[model samples]
Target: MTAGTRGEMDEAPQQLPGWAIPPSEGFTAADLDRLPVPAHTQLIDGGLVFRSPQSAFHTCASYLIVEGLRRHLPGHLRVRREMSVILGLRQRPEPDVCVIRAEADRAPDQTAYEASDVLLVVEVVSPDSEERDRKRKPQLYAEAGIAHFWRIENQSGRPTVYVYELDPATTSYALTGIHHDRLKLSVPFEIDIDLTEIDAL
Candidate 1:
């Protein structure tokens, strides 16, 4: 289904007609490749979770953040969007934006990035995905040992960024800062951004 299409996430039948039998051993990353699902769907904890269409604000904010990171981040890191990150045998989540070590070995046509290669993962909170982005994803990313996480939310109708750094001893994130107008961060890399400028783009 195309973006902005409603009803793409309707519940699937327990059993299908053709060779699409539900696996008894639970879903895996490989299963996502074989199954026919909406393009925005993610495989989370052995279930197919479909994301609703992104709003204009969501898309614009994601683009601006990626552009900001690319301009400021060092050459040794690569920024990407909507790429599936394999966190475990059964958990492969697609973050809105992600940064990874540039030198990490990857085939020319790798479909999913290994979690170990990821340096940071960013999720842009939507009305439908607030719970997953705020709670569920942080827990999963921490478990996968991803060093950094960022959550973007709308604050009074403007984009705001919340930054986090993983504390290894606890394997949980500590809030680093919350940005509204200006965002200057030192961890993961130093970058200063004007939040208002992001939306202007």
Candidate 2:
């Protein structure tokens, strides 16, 4: 999808094949490091999912959120992009954006941090990633007990921000907000953003 500025993202529609048989061996955290970073690929569910490169608008929006979160959040919060987070020994997801408390970011080495170390996870919805971002990922993050999950759809002339608080009962997330006029996020970071600026990008 191509947008002059920010318009409703023209997401590429593709349904993931239903699971029939489980894999004999799932990937581990160590496997992630061994797998070379490709041109446009991410590790998902013990598999390498190929994704298209992010668009200019998406990249800008991600940067905007990171900067805003950093500026508005307390000293304890750390904002990052493309950070490898290990939800479990068998699960390592490289989220587009993540926020972890100061202490969690204190690991002495490059080992991927665990989900318990993450406070929030954010994904920039791209044309080809509608399902993964809106559906698959939320479930995974929720299962990891992440307190906050955000989906930023930058295609809409204005960015559509979906805020969720993990629900323990369903092991999923409940949409806590739908910010149409502007972007407002209260968890992890207490900040409000004007969608007009996101669209103008």
Candidate 3:
């Protein structure tokens, strides 16, 4: 008989990732921390939403917006890109770009921000994220009491910004402006961005 004939192999089942089998209720925002690697993921209403690969237009548009905000940022505010905001226990979504209070700080180890810290949230609508950007996300952000949201759409390679502001009485966003070519604003602060810059990008 072979020496190993009497031995039985280990039968213990290996554990799986949180996403491999989500809980009955769905994943909590905190569960995102336990992912095996830094994933391009977001949690929406306890669901793990994986990101699709970004297109070139998505990259350029986001970059230009961030640069514009940084160049004109006031002393009390700062800009961040692709960072998750903790909107609720089960709601954590990454805005493509955000303007946050400076007090949130830039700690190298900070993984998330409280929704209250964000002054404005910007979503550069990817083809895959259009519905969320246009509907669900704005609802979540509004309910979280965030005051401003912008959705950017690519119109024949041009960036058109649809801006919204929170209505205090209803706690929902109201259409504030639809800007093309140049986006200038005054509510959050004095600002102007040449939307046409994407043509050169």
TM-scores for all predictions: 0.87, 0.79, 0.89
**Against the true structure, whose lDDT is highest?**
3
Candidate 3: where are CA atoms >4 Å away?
Answer: 1-19
The full ranking of all candidates by lDDT, starting with the best, is 3, 1, 2
Q: Pull out the clashing pairs in model 3.
A: none
Q: What is the lDDT of residue 63 in candidate 1?
A: 90
True-vs-predicted CA distance for residue 36, candidate 1, Å? 2.3
lDDT for each residue of candidate 1 in 103-137, tens digit (9 for 90 to 100)? 66477777688899999999999999988999998
| Superior candidate under lDDT, 1 versus 2 | 1
TM-score of candidate 1 versus the correct structure, residues matched by position: 0.87
Cα deviation at 28, candidate 3, in Å, is 0.9
Q: Lowest lDDT 10-mer window, candidate 3?
A: 2-11
